[model samples]
Structure formats: structure tokens, C-alpha cells
Target chain A: MNLIVAILSGAVVYAVSVLYAGIGETFTERSGVMNLGVEGIMLMGAMSGCVTAFHTRNLALAMLIVILTGAVLGLIFAFLTVTLQSDQTVCGMAMLILGTGLSGFLGEDIASKPINLKFTKIPLPVLSEIPIIGDILFNQNLLVYIMYLLLPLATFYIYKTRWGLKLRALGENPAVLDAAGENVFAMRYGYIVFGTTMMAISGAFVSLAQTNVWQEGMTAGKGWIAFALVAFSSWNPATLALGALLFGFISNLGSNLQIYLPGVPTEIFSAMPYVATIVVLIISTGNFRKKHTAEPAALAKAYDRESR
Target chain B: MSAMNKFRFEKREKQSALRTLIITAVSVLLALVCCGILIFSVGSKPLKVYETMLTQVFLSPTGIKNMLRSSLPLMFCGLGVALTFKMNLNNIGAEGQYAAGVIAGGAFVLFGPDIEGVPGMIITALCCFLGGAIWALICAIPKAYWGVNESITTLMMNYIALMILAYLCLGPWKMPRQNTGMTERIPRSMDIPEIMIGDIQISVGVFIGIIVAALIYCAYKYTTGGYQLTVISKSPKSAQYAGISIKKNILMVMSLSGGLAGLAGFMQYAGVAHRIVENMPNNAGYTAIVIAYLSRLNPFTVVVVSILFGGLQNSTAYVQSLGVPSQIATMMQGVIMIFVIAGDFFQRYRLVIAKEGKA
Candidate 1:
């Protein structure tokens, strides 16, 4: 593979992992529930996938385990923040800790060890042969292919449909949605679960598709980056997709550059993605020059039926 | 809804002090029970593990010293986090800020002039504080000025700070003739002294933590600046209406928070390790968040909770020999936090089952 194509292809592979979680968080924040436990949840999903693969050696079972783990966690989180009406930020932090702690405890035995299972790349027919573009985007795992459809489908789902409209309204004003005979609590619960399950898929991608190994807290700060990207892209799925790819390319560019410059400490390049997230977060949200943000008004606020 | 079982939660107008204490105590007890189950699941008898942990963490002289010794970083980090949290600024980057403090403090000890004893220690401490404050301000300025989410930005900065620390430890500052990832030890003149009380040794740094906590307590209870923080936390719009400078306070509180977290590095360096090392704070920064929240942002309570929580964190080392994973400490913190959050909700509201048909 040519160097440029390789980087682009690598970028796609990298972008898919975070994009799944990013888009998931987009849906979550859009529904007025901001989950800060993305890192923890991602770790748990990754751990569950690794454990299942090691024990069962069935990729299907591993994937199912990941989803089940995410569903259970997502339900607990929704119960705490939505039904219990706890502080979303604090609860989110607790969830993050809970996920990280649980995963770390459970996955301790597998640290630095191989799971002996991987999602092998399957290039699509004809599409994988289209000069440069095909190889860059088409030659990837099944999960990467799903992203191609997910991006547009999610954008259309949130913007073009009544359910999407209601989701947006739920974030902006749950009281208004409640007045319109909508099940505000149930809708929030549904989105929260869906978002968390998507985060699990993101984690499974890392363990089962990308690395094929289990490392404690191996998702690192990608979950945090996804959380920030929610605000960075101004809550637009299309823009968020582009931003994630840009991250993919820039982050890959660092490793590519390392081949030419060997004297600089490797940690600097490692820090690039995180530093970039901070910079991008500032650029997109910093209202510099009076740019408007499409933020959901009732975000992170608990809604009570009697209050309205 | 069935009339016989119909119930609703009603918020209390005021939560009494006794209720607050009861809620906290019950939550902690519940968390311990959950952790006991966790230990049992790992194949060890929960009773034996708890007995070992309780004795090792609190009973022995060395255990008492270690508990207070390990609590040093938590004291500073918890105080730091407690302050920013009071103003609703989620400065989760204290872990990174603590690293920045170590890096800066190390740089000074390696290159700066040698001054022995107390003044030198004070200067080094100040340097560490400045390092942490500067690291925190990176997120604070953007948050205060541009509405950037402080929580995410602070978190992202943790990786950045760790990278810089790793860069130094591996590249320029790597100790000569040693494979370990750390800088050289500080001069003996700069080391914080430990006084022996019978079989135990307590570093003066712990006193410094207590003093700092007391100072923060006074500021929070009596100062106009602290009053402004409460106003902003309650409602930014109302704070603005009342002419409180939210931006200035955000910058101030976050810097202080970061600086205090940075002081944790100083504790590890001068008081404990006497050398700058990688993973220095060891997640005391995150544990501090749980401590701060559980302590209810009270400085005096923060001191007490830091020791208890720090004991929980450090005591895992004792149980690792008994088939319990060291990560149990981290899990315990999470469990306790969840319980506390749930317990707080109960304290604020009560479910009243109403019999509408009978009435």
C-alpha cells in the first residue's frame, strides 16, 4: 500500500472506533442526558468482548456479551440520572468510575495478554478496487461498513423524522414535550440505552476488531474525546463525521511523522490526539467572534412532571 | 396507577444535619457490604479479607502511618477538587495537574539554587503550586472566556500532562545510570522532615494539609469570594444579575484547585518518595473527586474522608496476596460514590404511599 493510502485507510479504521461512540453521544446529549462515563463504559464493553472471546472463542457470542454488558450499565445509568433525578454530571462521573473500576477489576487477568480472536478485514467486491478512494474506505471490517450507513441514517433520523424532532424537543424542553402528550421520560430512557449500546459497539471494535487484545483501560481517552466532540461539531452528525475523520488523519499523521523524526520523545506524538481534542473543542464551541451554538437548552437538567 | 400502592417522592424544604450524617453513614455501610460481595466473588472469604484490611489499614502503628502517609496526596487533591466543584466547575484534570506540579517541582530541585531546610521546602512547594495552577488555567481560560465545557477539556488535558511527564522522565530528565523512569532525588535540605511518635512516623506535610484544609474552611464559610462561588453555582444568570464576576472566579477557583492537586506531587516527592516518578499521583486526583463529593464540599469533612478513602485505596495492597485484585480499591470508590449519590436523593425526598380510595 502507498504511504498516503495506508494512512487514510488507517485513519478510517481509527475514526470508526470513536465515531461509533461519538455519534452515540450525539444522540444522548441531543436527548438532554450527558453521560460522562463513556470511557468506563467503553472499557467495560472492551473487557466483556475480550473475556467472552477468550472463554467462548465465538465472535458472535463476544459481540452479544458486549451489547449485554452495555445494556445493563446503560439501564443503571438511566435509572440514576433519569428516574432517580440525580445530578447528571455527578452521576455521569460515578458511572464513569463504576465502569472503569468494574472493567479494571474483571480484566486484570487479561492485561498484556492476547484474546486470540480478531475481526479480519473483508474488502468489499468492486468497491475495494476503485483506484485510491476504494482502498482507503472500503477495505475494512464489517463494523466500518456499518458506519457508512450509520452517519447518514443518524443525520436523517434526527433531522428528517418526527421522532428526531421529538428527541430534539426533549433536550430543549421536556416540559413542552410532556405537554404535547409525549412520554418524555421513556424517550430519554430509550435514547440513553441506545446511546450506551452504541458505545459498547465502539469498545468491542477496539478489542475485537482493532487490537485483538485486552489491556486495562485500553480505550484511554478516546471516550473523553468523543464526549467533547459532541459539543465540538455543534451537534451535527455530518460535521461530527468529518471532524472524527480529521482527527483520524491528524492522529495517524503523528505516527507517520515518527518514521522520519526519531529524536523527539514518542510521548509528544501520543499526546497529539488529546491536545487536538482540546484545541478543536475550543475552536468549535468558544463563541469567538459571536458564533452561535446549537446547544439543547434543557441538557443535563432533570425533568419532573409536577414541576411543569 | 393502583390507589393502594400509589406513591410519590416529595422534596424536603430543608435537610437537617442529623439526616445528613445518617444518610452518609448508611451509604458507606451499604458500600462496604457491596465491596464485601465483590471480595467473595473473587474466591476469598469476605470476613477474612475485611478483617485483614481493617487491621492493616487502621490498627497497627505502621498501618496508621501508612494511612496518613498515603492520605497526603488525597488531602491536597480533595481540597483542590472540593473548591472547584463548589462552583460547579468540573476540573477533572487534577490528575494531570498533579503531574505538572511534579514536573515543575522536579525541574526546580534539579537546576535551581540549593537552600536547605524550611524556606527551600516552601519555595519548592510554591513552584509545584504554580505548575498545577498554570496547567489548570489552560482549561479554565477557555471555559470562562468561550463557554468551552470544562469537564471534557480538563479530562483531555490529563493525557497531555502525563505525556509531558513521560517525555521528561524518558528523555531529558531520565535519571543517569538507572533504567527506572524517574528523575534524581531532591536535595536532603529540601526534604520534609518526619517525626517519630513511638513506632510510627508522620511527615510534617500532613500538618500542612490540615492547615490548608482549615484555611479553605475559613475562606468558604466567611469570605465574600466564597459567597460569590455559591451564587454562581446556584445560577449563573442570577450571579450575573447580582454583579458577580463568574469568569474571574472560575479562573481563580480552578487555578487554586489545580495548584492544590499539584501539591500532592510535592507530598509524594519531599515527604514520601523523595524523587519524581511516573504515575506519581496514582489516581489520587480521581479518588479526590469521590472524596470531595462524598465530603459534601466541606473542607473539614474533606480531610476526614480523604483518610478513610485513601485508606480504602491503599489497603488493597494488603489483600492482593489473598487473591483479591488491587483494582478492588478503585471499584470500592465507585461503589461508595454511587451509594452516596443515591443516599443523598433519599435524604432530599421521601416516598409517601397514599391510599386514595380509602381516604
Candidate 2:
């Protein structure tokens, strides 16, 4: 029972971090922009958030700084990829390198010190009274509860809202969206910035809430896992949430197994999530039929008005 | 109508060499200025730091040797990356491939036959090449057959590769006398030979890297396979229409790329480190991507760019003396990449003022 509770709670915290990034990436991909710089953005967020929290001792201010940083970086990416029509893959790579380097350079001093302010688990009074599920859900940090709201809201926004329809349409066929007299470029810019802001928040959550300390490359490969989660979930926010949870569970299970089954190599456990991701990616993309797959048709292509 | 006219961008038929050089210089200059601002913000004198880096890296013999040593792996990895980039296959798995190579080549030195000299090195090189090729095939096969995103697959594989490398180093292959996460050192006979010119000593691996670059340049410019790769990269549909097999090309290019990266790892181990340890590759594979891009995937140009980047990396130690963090080098690399990528746009298209009645 204790193991089950531990696993469930661990999974939730882990899921919240990736879920934020997954949802952000889902939105960006839905608008046909694939930002491979999520890892770098997360690092930037973690560093900035930790530094802000270290000085000001305010969690909210740290998060706000993360969002602002994400917005600025996203704007730079959008300008290069969308406005200048540069190769998205190369641009994303450049962003990743830039983010990682800059964050490491800036966070050198703070990495050695731990921030005082960190997000603590906020238990809801009424919700905390429920059985196993309540403890797992309500006993999580504030961001976890926010994530619960975000998943459904994102779903409804993506499926039901007019803007959401246009966003999906932008990914599938930007020319059609342009023909409908909508500004495709502006929509992409907005989604990219909003999505990356979420990615930054996810990073902040890792350093400020999950670990409660600053470290270089603290996000590790969580951003990459989140990026993979977008594909694993087929660009659906609800599916992405479930995928994040599934990955988080696998991640938790590995660590738990390390404690319980001490004889087994820890490296095997460390390699599990990545190996599973590759297997899932293969299976998801292996299907022959196009209709079964929910990949954005114009995922990495630059929209050129003149070319069309 | 005149009032309504605005500036427009015109695609150039061809960007002249002089124009490209100018644009590249401007981009690099702009990146330096941006990095200078960052250095200033951190309360450091940017010019003093730059001067120290330049003198310590280029003006000193010891610095030049260190720079050349660092450039060896980068040149090899850069050429490897360039191979995949030529086919538009984003194989960011060079880091993993490098590790795989070290494992394969290092394993040969540690546990293989007690052979000595040229025969031993040849066998080690072959083993490393095969290891890298096989590691890269993990992603290439899926990408070729199922259209799996190579970028993500390759990136994920890197973690798995590193984990496996770590497991081996810390477990089975660990040196018997030490508890550190490192493997047994290779025998003295297995060490790669170095050449001495006056007071400077350079490894044979550097020459190998140059030879590989020249060979790749010839292959890319003058071979049928290169032509097929170019066609496939430009438009896979056209390549398919031309009876070129996309799957075969992907496997071929990816294998070659991985093999080269693996050779780089082998060089670093056999030529320099002489032991398999965690963090051996450091971020050479990632840095190689930047070198490949900055050189526009040209093999010869990759060699030149790698040397410059190598100098930047070597100067980190010198920069650290001025109270600047070593990460400043990495940050500068990132800045250079972003600026160069942005500058590439100008080479392809020229911004011009619109004239009345142009539309």
C-alpha cells in the first residue's frame, strides 16, 4: 500500500513537469512548428527561476520571469523560423545550443547555492478526505492542480473553440487558413510564444518545486521526454496528459525498482524511459495507414506566401 | 500607388563568394558583439577576455597544440554530421555513436588479442567504425522504413548509449585497483602514435581527420552516390522518381555519419585520453553540429571551422583566469550559430526597397 501510494504520488509530480511541456509542445506542433529547443528552454527556465527565487525568495516572481524568458526566446525562434523562413530543424538546434550555453553561463554562480523558496504540496481540505485518489491528486503541489485544470481547458480550447479549430487547421493546411482571411503568421507566433512559456514554466517547476534546488542541466532530459510525449500522444492534449502520466509512472517504477531490487543495475533503470520512448515512437509511426496517425501535415514546413 | 509601395525581398540567383564571406564575417562580428554585451553584463571586460583567449589559444605553442588536439574529434564528428545533413537527415546521435565507438575500440584494446602496432590499430578502427554504424542503424532503419522522426529517435538513443557506457565503465570494465567510474587503460602498445615538430607534438589522428575530410569532399563533389544523396535531399520524391532508393541512401549516409563519429571517439580514447571514462566525449558531438552548420556542411570548410571552434574551447582555461566561467565558450558558440543561421537568409535573399508600380 505504501509502495503504491509512493509510486502514484511520484508519478503525479513527474507527470506535472512533463505535462506542462507536453501541452506546450502540443500547441506549438498543432500550429505546425516543431521546437526541438524545449530542453534548452527548460534549462533557461530552471536557471532563471532558481536565480530569481534565490534573490527575491518569491516563487510567483520566479515563475513570471520564466514565462517572460520563454516569451522572448520564443519570439526569437518565431522571427527566425516563421518570419525569416529559416529551416526549422537547424533553427531549433541553434536555439537548443544557445539556450543550454547561455543558461549554463548565467547559472554558474547560482548552481552552487540552493534557493530558499520552493513550491510545497498544497492539500485541499475537502478533496484531501477522499480515498487513495484524493491523496494522489490533492496532495500534489499547486502546479499539479493547475495542470489538472490545464488539460481539460486545453482540450476544450483545441477542439471546441473557433481559434482552436483555426490553430489545428494551421498545422494541417496553412494555405487554407490564409485563404479564409485569417493571419496564419500571427496565430503561429501567438501559439509558439504561449507554448514555449509553458515549457519554461515546466522547467521552473522542476528546479523550484520538484527538486527545490538549482543545478546545471537540472531538467536533464525531461524536456526531450515531453517532446517525445507530444508524438506519443498524437498531438492530443488529453492523450498527452495520459502519456505524460504513463511515462512518469514508468520513470517512477524504475527508481522504485532500484530501491526494492537493489541487485539490478541502476543504469538499466536509468535507460528504461528513453528505450521505451524509442519503442513507442517506432510503433506509433510504423502504421501504414495515414488516417490512423494524427501527425501535423505541415509540421516542419515553412509557410511561404510567394511560393504557393 | 507610390505611397503604397513598400520594401520587398528578392531571391538571388546566386550568392557570390565575396558576398558570402562578407555576410559570414558580419554574422561572426555581430555574435562577438552580442557575447561582449553578455560579458559586460556579468561585470567582466569583454575586450580583455577576448584578447586573453586569442593570445593564449593562437599566440602560444602549448595553446596551439591543445587546440589541435581538441580539433581532432571535432573535425571527425563535423564531417560525420555533414554527411547526414547533406541528405537532410538530422542525426543528432553523434554523441551516442562516439560513445559506442569508444566502447568498441576500447574493448578491443582491453580484452582483444594481444596484437601490437599497425595491425592492432587497424582492427580497433574497424571495430569502432562498425560499432558506430550499428548504433546509428537503430534510428536509421526506423526513419527509413517508417518515417520515424530521426531527430527525436537519435536524441533519445543518446541517453541510452551513455547509460550503457556508464554501466560498463562502472561495472564490468571498471579498473580493478580504483573505484572511480572509469575502465582499465589501454596497453602502451595500443596507444596511437604522435609526431613531433620542434617543441610541439601532434597526434596522427589529426592527419587522419584531414584525409577523411578530403575524401568526403571528393565523394560529395564527384561521385554518383553523392549525386543521388543530393537529389534525395533536394526532393525525395524526385529521387524516387529517378529510381533512386531513399531507404538505401538513408541507411548508407547515416551509417557513414555514425562511423565517422565513432572514429572520433576512438581517436579521443586511443589518441588522447587512453581510457574509457564518463564524460569522455564532453559535448564534442553537439559542438560538431554547430561546426557542420557554420561550415555549410562542406567537409573542407568543416576542418577550418573546427580549428576555430577548437581554439575557442581550448581558451576556456585561459578565460577562467579572468573570473569568467568556462561556459562562456559554449555560450559564444551558441551565439555564433544563431547569428550564422540568421545571416544565411541574407545570402539567399536580398532586401530591396520597392519602386512605384512594381506590383
Best by DockQ: 1
The candidate 1 chain B region of ten consecutive residues with least summed lDDT is B1-10
Individual DockQ of the candidates? 0.79, 0.78
Clashing pairs for predicted structure model 1, backbone only? none
Q: Where is model 1 more than 4 Å wrong at Cα?
A: B197-199
Interface root-mean-square deviation of model 1 in angstroms is: 0.9
Tens-digit lDDT track of model 2 for A19-108: 888899999999999999999888898889998998888878888899999999999999999999999999889988888899999888
DockQ, candidate 1, vs. native dimer: 0.79
Q: Write the residue-wise lDDT of candidate 2 on B1-359 in tens digits.
A: 45545677889988698898899999999999999999988878999999998888977888878888888888888999999998899999999999888889878888898876788888998889888888999999999988888998888888888888888888898888887888877767778888889888777888888899889888878999988988998999999999999999999999999999999898888787888998777888899999999888889889989988989988888888788877987899999999998999999899888766775
| Local distance difference test values of all predictions, in order | 0.88, 0.88
